[model samples]
Each structure stands twice: as structure tokens, then as C-alpha cells.
Target: MDTMTYDYTEPVLSPKGQKMRDILADYITVVSHRLPDDVTKKLVELSKIEVDPLQRLIYDTMMENQMLAGKLKRPSCQDTGALQFFIKCGAKFPLLSELNAILKDAVYRATKQAPLRHNAVQTFDEFNTGMNIGDGIPSVFMQIVDDSADIEMYVYMAGGGCTLPGEAKVLMPGEGYEGVVRFVMDRMTSYGINACPPLLVGVGVGTSAETAALNSKLALMRRVDSVSPNKNAAKLEHLLEDGINHIGLGPQGFGGKASVMGVNVINTARHPSAIGVGVSTGCWSHRRGKINFDSDLNYDLPLNEGVEL
Candidate 1:
């Protein structure tokens, strides 16, 4: 059988644009190998809390996995997942026009350099793109900031297992915030195990299902130990974290003292008639990174300390 290749034309970029693309590609590869600082810290904290022999063993193995992955400069998980970028770009940024093309090219480069799994399949076409650059494969969600010349981005690898538990729904207004809690708890009990337990749960509350879903994903980009700024939302974060931990899914769903590293809540105002809630989870691997760049292309990676790209 002849090997099939998806045709994707590379965009011609300016010198600066090419530089940015290469930097992003290197960043992606680094993100693939090393868990972010917050995630690593949380895992270590959780490991000490588990007493069951098998549970402790699982945590030990997880630590070993990270050490080996970093030492060998290889991906920690076989499933590298589809790449997603949540970007906050300034209106005055120099590369704004070329940002999209640069990002797509960067993913293509990372696919080869990281040896990431062939996860981008065309819908209805039923074949892998091979390059990991298919129609909207590296999903980019951007928010524009006025009067600045810098950009901040969150790069996430949304693997299948972690994404399996994601869901959103709109509840009647009368159901109240308590209803949001009920909805999240229900999902956590039913499907959180499949996401590889000791998960990082993200809850989004907004005006509609779509808004809530987007907020839920944004929630996942936050630091594992961070709490919501809104006082009520912060309270709810603790509430949901305690509620999910009570499930006792433990390390890899094997049953133990803790089922979650943390729960983050991101909320926006909603209409009077309805309440929308969405839930998303990050597995124990939790491969996500944050990078910031100035107009001159100087960059800083706050999530993975000591990583140079």
C-alpha cells in the first residue's frame, strides 16, 4: 500500500516570524518532556499523603517516570495529545499578522522534534494528518489586549483520557450555585476515574454552555495550587476540591486518600434565567506550559523553570 500524505503548504515567513516559530517549536518539545513546576510540586505533595502500598507505589512510579523523561529528554507519556494554545496577544504586537501561521508551523516542527504521537485526524476523512497540522489541529484561542506589545500563551496537550470527562450544561436559574456543585460532583463520580485519578479539575461557570466550556478549559491553564480571585468562587473551589477528594479514586484510580490534586473554578457573570457550568480535568501527567514574549521576541517560560528555548 502506498503511504498517504496530507498536503499542507508551509507559510513563507519573515526572518523574525521564523525565529518566533522555532522558539515556539522548541518550547513545545520542552513542554512534552517536563511537567510544569506547579504540577510537579503538587504530585510530590500528594505522594506523601498516600499510605496504601499500591497507591504509594503508583506515586513512586510517577516520580520515576518524570525523572527519566527529563534525564533522557524524551516525552513522559506516549500520548502527546493534540496541541492547544490559549493566547493573550497585544494589539500592538509586531507579529500579530503572522501569529496564526507561525503557531501552526511551530506545531508541525514540534511534531517531528518531539516525536509527538500522530494525533491529528481529519474529521470524516478518517486518516491521520501525520504532520499534526490538519484543519484547526492546533486549536488557538486568543484574546486581544489593547495598547501593548507583548504576548502571553498557555500551551496544553489535551490527551484523550483527560478530555474524556469534559462536559457542560445549562441549569435553570432556580438551581443556583448549589446546582453547579451538584453537576460537577456528579461528573466527577461518574467519569473522573477514566481521566487517571488524582486529577486537576477545572470548573467554568458562565452565561451559556459554550462560555462555560471555554472557561472550564481556561481554568485548566491556571496553576494547580492557585485559587479563584472571586471570594465566592474561591469558597466553591475548596468545596469542590473536598467533594471530589472524597471520591477516593486515588492514584490511577486505585483507591486512596486523595482523588484530586486541586479544583480550579473560573467564572463570569451569567443571565438571570440560567446558570451554565462546565467541567474539564487534567490527568496526573498534566502537560501544560505558559510562556510570555515581548515585542522584541525575548521570552520567558514561567511554568517550566530552567527550561531554555
Candidate 2:
């Protein structure tokens, strides 16, 4: 997805645009060092369910890591990860023309301010940019909203381990939705341990592999306690959660009672002949944040509490 290129002239930013950039940069910094409220809450819930001594210690260590990261104002993990911005912006928004430059600049500044690990490397050529900005680094996906002035953004740190098992495949018509479950379970059993279990699993079902893959990542933006709106998808989420936790990969994959925080499934109408399924996992850290803003640059951090930027 990062291979695609775009040609557009950059624009100068006004005061509002500049403010937006600073806000996003700081938001990224905070997200890197702090866990989102939902993720923190889920971890607390999981930590309480473990019985094994080693597994309980692992959970304790996870909490200590977060505490230290917060106190030191440093990234919670060494792999600060590839920055991904999923933006839903209004076409009529005042800074529309400068959004791209604003986001890129925010990423650049956040890299230095957060002291984020330089994770962006040129593909194939094998060279690190050392600044997390490259031809297509810090992936940005945007969707335009028609007649409104509100923009919603989701920032995600797609760490290597979390994304390693991400896969999408189109199943034959005969394979049915059961194929989707099998695909997720298969991937989880194979690599769930590596991703820091008590993982949040995202599954996508759609008409093609690419669509499913995108939807799968989007699924991770949902709250850990929320179920899919669609009845069938919600059922699948619960079933996948149960099946995964039953695997007993436990905290940090050391074997315990809980293997996952939750399972999220997002779907769209599929082509008559195909069922596409994709899987992505977020490690226990689950570093993702949501913020909403107006054209005036006024914003709210819904996933964060008692924080102002």
C-alpha cells in the first residue's frame, strides 16, 4: 500500500494549519509513550485473570513498563513503529489544501520530540532515513466527508511483531464464512505468541483481499469493549475472542487463562463468488489513539482522559 505515489504541490499553512500540525505532533508523542484508556483498562482486566506465577509476573512487568514509560516521557516500546494516520476529513475543512504537508510535518517533528525510533527504511534499496519520513513512510489514508467541518483521525503504531502475521486471502464460495474463522484461528495459533498475547485481534471480511486487509486494520480502531454493529459480525467477534482465549497463550504468551483482550470484526458486502478474510493483531500495548477536530482546530482526545493539547 505504501508503494503508491502522488504528485502535488505543497501549500503554505495559515495559523490554524500550524496549530493543527503541532497538535498532531504532540498527540503522536503522547500515544507513543502512553497507552490508550481502553487498552489500559483491558490490560488491567486481563492481569486479574491470570493464575500462574510466571504469567502474573509478566503482567506485572507490563504494568511497570507502562509506568516507567509515562514517568520518563519515553516511548513505551523500542520499536516506535511505522506511523499510520487514518484520516476522515471534511472536504470543506479550512486547511484541506495543506493537510498532507501538515501531517508529514507533524510526523517529522514527532519523531524528534518523542525520540521515536527511526523505523522508516527505503524498501528494496535497504537504507534507513533515520527520520521516519521517506517515499511512502508514515502511511496516510484519507476519506473525504461531504458537507461537514469535522475531521476525525486515528493514529496507530503498527509495530513489526503486530503486523507480521497480517494476511489476507480470498476463499472460494464453497468455503463460506467458516473459512474466515479458520484463517484467523490458524494465524493466531501460529504467531499470536510473538505479538504479546492478550492481543487485540482484528478481522475483516469483504469482496477482495485488499479490501479485507484495509478493513482489518480499521477494526483495530474500535474500542476494546465494543462489539461490531452488525449482528453476525458481532457474533463472530465474540466467537473469535473465545476461541483465541481458549488457546491459553496467556500474558506475553507464557500460558495463562486469557490470550486476548478482544476480537473485532469489520465487514462489507462480499461478491457473490468470493469471501475475503484478513487478520491483524495488536500487541498488549495496543498503541492507537482517536481524536476529533473542527475546522477551527478545536479538538477532543476521546481515547485519552484529562489531557489537553
Best by TM-score: 1
Lowest lDDT sum, 10 consecutive residues, model 1, at 1-10
- Candidate 2 segments exceeding 4 Å error: 1-12
Q: What is the lDDT of residue 19 in candidate 2?
A: 91
Give the Cα error of residue 192 in candidate 2, in Å.
1.3
Cα deviation in Å at residue 66, candidate 1? 0.5
Against the reference, the lDDT scores of all candidates come to 0.93, 0.89
RMSD of 2: 3.5
**Candidate 2: worst-modelled 10 consecutive residues by lDDT:** 1-10
Residue 206 CA displacement from its true place in model 2, Å:
0.5
Report the Cα lDDT for residue 123, model 1. 85
